[model samples]
Target chain A: MTHTVLVTGVSRHIGARVASVLAADPEIGRVIGVDTAPPPSLSSDGGVPLGRTEFVRVDPRGPDIAKVISAADVDTVVHMSLVSAPPRSGGRALMKEQNVIGTMQLLGACQRSATVRRLVVRSTTAVYGSSPRDPAVFTEDAEPAEPPAHGYAKDACEVEGYVRGFTRRRRDVTVTTLRFANFMGPGVDSPLTRYFTQPVLPTALGFDPRLQFVHEDDAVEVLRRTATEDHPGTFNVAGDGVLLLSQCARRAGLVTVPVPSSAFQLMGELARGAGLVDFSPEQLRLMRHGRVVDTTALAAALGRRPAFSTATAFDDFLRARDIAGGLPAALMDLLTRAVAR
Target chain B: MSDVDRRVAELLALLRRRVTGEYEVDEFGFDPELTDKVLLELVRPLYRDWFRVETTGMEHVPADSGALVVANHSGTIPLDGLMLQVALHDHHPARRALRLLGADLVYRLPLLGHLARKSGHTLACREDADRLLRKGELVGVFPEGFKGVGKPFSERYRLQRFGRGGFVASAIRAQTPIVPCAIVGAEEIYPKIGDLRLLARALGLPYLPVTPLFPWLGPLGAVPLPSKWVIGFGEPVRTDEFDPADADDPMVVFHLTDQIREIIQQQLNELRLRRGHAFPPFF
Candidate 1:
């Protein structure tokens, strides 16, 4: 059992939920939430009781993270601070620093610490890279036919490389990397999320690749299990089954505007420029070819079955989206049914 | 309610149920509903009218348990896989949908790949085949692969080497019977005369066949020849007699594979003699 855990990226929704869940567990001795900013208060009616987690302000990219880890004498470290999108101001350079440089410093801190025995890093399936030549389902051991072209995917690839290096040096530490599919749930912000949230969804003409999603709750639960348990090695974390991109849009109640691949590329750039969207080129590639990861190891080796499948998670996200938009429960139900049909 | 309204309501019910809870889909992303709605519908016409496919020995396929359907793959554009899928669904007493193993190229094409999955086709991998068999689902294999599909017109109906007998090993491991399937009249559909090597490579295709009509008549030439098709399913080769450990024995796998190949090739010869001609009008 893990005692006195340090959870990074607590300012984010997933990190905060994980931190709170850990705090509520009677077996865990202490819960420390670390981020550059103060964590938002857990709502009054939240499942996990508030005020149990001790908040610490520390940037993972800086040297102070080491001090926090040493001072707390944390036995387990859950790194969830990896950014999925580029910052509005500094863009690529800033994202690289936050993801790559931040991971290096965090790993450096854990390497020097005598108390830390377990480390869990949040990664994405983007490392596999979408390509026409890729296999139908990529096993954990499959090499990327084409390396990540740019942005978060390339950075994620680099971050994983560094983590592997850390593993080689500190063979004693149990390193678990969870490569998640596109996260879809209430309050999760991602490029795909933004695309679907829009009233009109643009798709590449004549292309509808398979898509996968993991509910935010399942994503958080898997992280907690990894921190509390002792599963090692890399695992692909995605809910079962897949949906076509068109199916996703129809479920989301969005109007799909099919455009040629070249025109869609131009529109993506223009949309980003106009601040209407942040559609990255790599994401565009993903939309066209679609990406899916095999989750056999996640269940067989890691011993965790997700509560939701891809279609259910997506439906739940849509349910939440419709409800938040002020549709009554019954009408939302009817709308979901009608759209699904 | 009127008939249209009732259909609308039923449609709504289906959508609502699909959105509400988790139902089961196989590991390869098979969707029975969509398969019925789209893929089978598209193939039904070709299977029934265009090709006029006639199937025999349908009883050989087990009703309740898994069996491997190993067939000779032909036609430059391989419609044999789809035809077999329809035959199993329509002709067999069990009406079990055969999970046809497909090539990587099938998965590479965006729209084609999506439809293939919904239609219960998966990558021709050992892991998928093993899992499907263990689940007691009937699985189909076209071991001849691109070699049989892309062979020249002169080599029509000639059986190619089955790839290393991986399917036999999978069947042995799963303890499932292997049913040899032979598809006649598929070879003459495309009549592949030449291979456009440079164009095929540039297009990321396995091989671009230059049929007599193709490249001369443009897209119109690409239509299939509508040759009469016959599918024969041979008796199951029992793998239960061999210990599951024999799956690892390469020699056993090879011998079994060769035996299955001979069965299929012999069936093909018999089918030709029975039909009397490669293309018999309105037979």
Candidate 2:
């Protein structure tokens, strides 16, 4: 049977990739991409008219979102929309409103849609909160960490509640919530990217905490399976590999600068106070400890290996920036000019 | 002089006898002295030098009766349970050997099964628990089961499913006091940062835990740091006091489970405050 999928937040990096992957699948007859952001210029490789995937520029919290989504004739709804930018003015409130009201709107739309059979919600590992140094691996069954300064995670979980609760009324629709780890790949430009890009990477307390990352492709694959596959319940999606923050920085061709724990804490406090970052004191404390997530259920459900490694993901990022071999040509030229001067 | 000291000695003697008798084997050319040697040498050294392992409310554990000791399972590996066994034998009032209710996977392994049996662990089955309790033995159970031990590092200290109150049911049938034990510092020993469920199922394990280092670092990852552990025993939930008919009631079981969970959580909180650190420093 040809599956028609409605994927929200399709303009975002992960969401766009998910939409493209699903649209390319031979089994999927149609894909409806919904996002508040302006549509990307790239066309689907399948040569299907970009308009066929119907990009709806409607706010998820608004009443029009349901009407737009229902009009797409979607058989499956993947709720991936969220305000994920580093918190701006009222970013936390926006995330909560969008996540909670948006999910309710989408779920309400799905409820009315006669063809909708499944709902896959993208959640974040942040829901697990900061990792403690002990028992480093987080399992699906563990208690969720208390809400952090980044309210997106907590709100996403609340969104999950709506999707999951909808399952009780609608048995036909299976809801799968995926709590993803740090996702990195081509075009990835998060704070961690900035950390790696820094000429001298700062180490926390002279001990670089361990980091876990998933390749964007693998993340998309997991999302694809969640949308099409029948498995229900939450799963942690992360890379198969774990590396120290220092190792990641070193891999990115940056020198490590050891900093005292007190200094790191002070810097973190200042950043939080300035609203430059969303991490809380508790989250900061957790950053000292490395978190390993158990991806057992995700791998089992997906039935494949992750598409990329930490090294490969970093390499892809470097390639995307056109600095795979060394520094970019422009930067190299500037350095040479300075040396000449 | 204290009841705990006398009981500890008795349990030590009992363990020694059992180790000599039922545990003695040379099938795989196993060293007869390995168990004793580990108990006395490897474990004792760390127990003495690394950190202070303390246990409180030993009297809560009945001195001469079969009691179900339900503890919060942590420590990515089962090191917490092993340490608890050592502490109970070295400090409890009756000093009775604890028969750990292990996951079925432990018994499924060849060498691991033999060693587990030698270590006095059996499948965490109701029948096994019932049989042991009826035999007037101390049966140790981590009702949080794999979920507690296998929890992601982010969700550390959060308890998991209590397994539908089977432990309570077993204790009630045997009229045993369910001694609730809260174990702190175990979760810090081997942090489980991620889980690869595919790998876990492929390996026939409950959850393939990616600890701080495991497969990449090999055995070093398995060697959990000896964190100062505090095993606080809460007042036992007396199953005998409850109506037998209430045993099947959902509300009765829920209340009992909640009470036990609260005790464990409270004790964990108190222990955390007492330590003032996530883990005891390793010298």
Best model number under lDDT = 1
Candidate 2: regions farther than 4 A off: A40-52, A86-90, A131-134, A144-150, A258-266, A272-286, A318-341, B1-283
TM-score of each: 0.87, 0.52
- Please write out the lDDT profile of model 1 over residues B1-283, one tens digit for every residue: 5788778677665655444322344456677876766578888999999888998889899999999999998999888998999999888887898898888777666578767776888787776788789889899998989999999999888899898899999999999999999999899888999999999999988899999889789998889998889999999999999999999999999999999999999999988666566567755
User: Chain A in model 2: its TM-score?
Assistant: 0.82
Write model 2 residue lDDT over A181-227, tens digit each, in one string: 77787655455554455456556653434467788888888888788
Which docking band does candidate 2 fall into? incorrect
Question: What's the iRMSD of model 2?
Answer: 24.1
lDDT of 1: 0.84
Tell me the tens digit of each residue's lDDT in model 2 across B1-283: 5787667555555443332222222211122344444543456555555546777888888888899898898877777777777777668766666778887566444345446554556666665677678878888999888888888878877777787887787787788899988888888777888888898888888887787677679877777765777788888888988776676777888778888887888878887677666554633
Q: What is the C-alpha lDDT of each candidate?
A: 0.84, 0.69
lDDT string for model 1 (A41-79, tens) is: 556322333348898888667999899889989999999
